[model samples]
Target: MRGFTVIWLGQLVSMLGTGMTNFALSFYIFEQTGQASALTIAIFCFVAPSIILSPLAGALVDRWNRKVVIIMTDLAAGIVTLVWLTIVLTNGNLEMWQIYLGNIITGAFNAMQFPAFSAAVSLMIPKEQFARAAGMLDFAGAASNILAPAFAGALLGTFGLVPIMLVDVITFLFAILAVLVVHMPQPAAEMIPEGNKRPSLREDSLFGFKYIRERPSLLGLQFVFTALNFISAFGAIIATPMILARTGNSAASLATVQSIAAFGGVAGGLIMSTWGGPKRKVQGVLLGMSAENLLGPIVIGLAKAVPGWAAGSFMSQLFIPIINGSNQAIWQSKVPPAIQGRVFATRRMIAQISFPVAVLIAGPLADKVFEPAMSSDGWAAAIFGPIVGTGAGAGMSLMILLSGIVGVVIGLVGYSIPALRDVEDIMPDFDALTAPIVNNEPAIQSQGE
Candidate 1:
């Protein structure tokens, strides 16, 4: 417990530093290029690699000492951060491709870090504390969300991105030190004769998919997320930027708006920490998704349509992650421990495949189809006039509206699917929330040999 506590604290600091660096980097790109396209590319690079390299990373995580994996990732990440800063300082100008490369490399290393950490947590923490611990972990991110933007703004106004990058490097070093101090006791099963063991990598990576294949319900649940991410793309990436451009807010103000949204996430995290989740984790997930999905576009679109961009963004930020965390809690408990590295990674790969694609198409889609129609005196005002509005942000608002409707429809249809609905009943006993309802029997107790 002491070891875990120490590691968690250090990682919290690292998370904050990571958040600050991201904030600084996004604004730096904006300041240099004055184009939203560059910023979108940076975001794309950061996320796309996880989908690309996850299978290999997952395989390796199951085969390695998990603690060593965490430490190595921290050390490598720190070195990369330091080198990037040094290069920027040595050179008078930074190129767009250089930043793009940095982001892609960062994403690649991050791909290794997450699976190892998650699988390690599953090994280290007892089931009773799993949801509670997850809540606190999310809270750390929420806190970072609240502060990182402001911290980056301060650093930018004072010394700049290079200094903030240094701070990130230092935080990584500190986090690595924490990992060094903690001893991750090996799982008892790992001590058994090597020949009798499952093929660690192959078995781990394929297990989650196999589980989903057999259950169908869990697969359906995850499939719903895939649908949601693609549908929401129209609003999240496209409409918000257009709205801000129309309103004449600077890059800094937009960052501030995002920070306000983090405040919402913090509140939601705190609430989940105490409540755990609803009696039925799946029902809570569905309910939360339904509620937040509608609110997101409304908040995002109406802000552009009216004068409430800040307020709208804030509300969406607050609720969306809470729903997401609830979904994560469900998966964490439901999936078996040995296969989590591969299974969860595979699930992540599938769910996020659409994100980069959606991001790629979002801007263009807005420019070619949605934006033109919603412009003043465009077909939007002439035809679909009432719901779309008649102002600067009309097109963007309409897009948000459309995405929201799609998220809701997908969620409802997902709820109706018996396979997804009954995954709670059919899958092995995991969480009490869905366990008894599914099996009509007692729960499985963990009895290590």
Candidate 2:
């Protein structure tokens, strides 16, 4: 727990820096070009490499020293930051391609970092504490989401990009130092599942999918989350535009509503950390997500005012941490420590595959399909318009409403799957298999702080 705590604190600092830098860069690009497509390209570069390369990265994490992986990734990321800073300092300008390339490099580093850090977590923390640990991890993300924009906005206005980049570099140094000092327990020889044999890198890279396929419970959970991710992405893709259009493009109102909503995620993490989720973790995840999916779209779709949208958004965001924390705890408790890197990576890759697709289509869907349909003279305007109302962003609202219905159906279907719902009962806990070396204190000395 102590080692995990140290790493968590370090990662949170790094995340805050990363978040601020990302916000500042995105703002810079948008301000310079005034092109929405530029922002899209930047985001694509940020996420695409990680998704495409996660399988290989996961295989490496499982094979390599976990602490080394964490340290090296941070080092690589820091180096990229240094290069960016150098370009700014020397060249006095940065091309879009260079920024895109840097984002790709950082994304690749993150692909490896996530699996390594998550696998390391299961080793350092007790099985019963996985939920609380997951809460703390999520709190990092929620806190960054809330704090980074505020912090970056102020710093970018006062000190400019140079100071923000320097701060990011410092944060990376802090993260690397923490990893260097802490000892991460490695998987023991005996911890490998019985009869499992080492294979080539290619075969091992695909092993996560194969391993999940062998277990109905694991497979079912994966499918459920894949659906959840796909559904959630649609709403996320249009959340800002929806608010802006509905609120008559008042940027302050949009920011206020979003910030208020984001606090829900932080609040949810705090609650989960205290409660440690429900006895039936899967049930808790499904029910919480179901409420989030069903209620949010309805309120937002029918919202005639910003307050309505804000309240709905707040409730929707609130359930995210609960779902994520409960889901992570289940995976941590069920999967073998040795193979967790591969398994968790595969889980992330599949769940996130929908996001890029969603982002790509969201604008077109709203502009060509939904928006016109809900136009004053369009066919859908007569039907759904009377209900959700008509005009700008109404089609997006309709999409949200439809997406919510689909999400609810998916949750109900997941709940009905006995294998998934009863996963804890059917799958044996991996703690028994990995108990011997789960906590290796020799690898990490307690630095009397």
Candidate 3:
């Protein structure tokens, strides 16, 4: 099979496996002990390790053989998941730290897999097709997300997490096999000198950062969305749950909403596959932001008041693949193959920082401010009394509106920023993809820092 074809298949299978693991694990931990903090710790364990190691992972990816990196990570992940599956099968005693440890290790492996995959994409796919490929990848992920919860429930109730984990293990094994079968050429001579003693893995990883330094625009482009990511986290996770609680939405309804949202991703991906995204893919990003700005928060806010939550989640989700697909195309076209792994890895690392912080603040805000503000005759009643309104879950509604306002303002700011809003004009190179060398070998150093 062609490298891209193999990769696309691997991604689809792996995403489904991952989605199942996520659903099963979250449900398992929550059902075991309803403490919110347990879940929080689990999340922190999973995410924090990855965050801490991203810089190192990117650098290593640039220096290492991309295919080898991918295979190794998959192999390790499969082994680890297998072990976890056995623990689940035995119905042995489980501990919080054990779950955390498992989460942290898996997350680290996942982080390593990203750079390798992104860099590989740069080597394998037609530049113009980047968006379409991304759309497909996004769609697969979204579809998997939709199926995971229901699948997890079935597996858990019948055979439990062990059986589900066995499936995950098999998925990882297949993913590794896919990578093993593909051929990936190496970096350019220009990027890695002909005879200079090969640098240590750490030094190679840092090359990604250096590459970014050479191109300031790429660095800046990554930064433009930092604020948006930070704020969106709060609205996406915290706000929805709080508002839903206020509404008559049941647990199953919330899960249904979550599952339905994936269809939007499917639509976006299918559309991009056919449309190949906009002429200037950056416009897709901007458009996505604009849509998220206006639609997402409004849906979350009114979910309680209107029946929109019944369908809004799906509607909003539809935009995700559209935006994600466009972003992938833009990156693929601009970044050189050699450096793509490191650069994309570094990019992901920086972008993800907002999530933890956002979650931290979000938990408190929903608990303290948003929830109480609109409560019957609460704080807002005394001040913005007329603004929020009387009764009828005004606070949650107000929070949603404010979230939308924040998203819109952020989009406007992005529009104003010359480098970000007008990235296509400045980085016009994305419009053109020239085959630079024989064998489609990687030509750029990976980005890491």
Greater TM-score among 1 and 3 belongs to 1
lDDT of 2 by residue, 131-172 (tens): 998888777777766777677777876676787788889999
lDDT of 1 by residue, 182-264 (tens): 88765433222322434455565665566566667778788888888888777777643555556563646766676777777
lDDT of each: 0.70, 0.78, 0.67
lDDT of 3 by residue, 56-139 (tens): 887777767888988888887777778777775676645767788887887787788877777777767677777877777887
In candidate 2, the residue pairs with backbone N, CA or C atoms under 3 Å apart (3 or more residues apart, or in different chains) clash, namely: none
Q: Which stretch of 10 consecutive residues in model 1 shows the poorest summed lDDT?
A: 435-444
**How high a TM-score does candidate 2 get?**
0.86
Q: Give candidate 2 misplaced runs (Cα > 4 Å).
A: 25-41, 81-99, 156-162, 190-197, 244-251, 304-306, 372-379, 386-392, 433-449
TM-score of each: 0.86, 0.86, 0.84
- Which ranges in model 3 have alpha carbons more than 4 Å from their true place? 32-37, 91-93, 157-159, 190-203, 239-251, 305-307, 372-378, 381-401, 428-449
Assess the local accuracy of residue 419 in candidate 3 as a C-alpha lDDT between 0 and 100: 77
Write the number of the candidate with greater TM-score, choosing between 2 and 3: 2
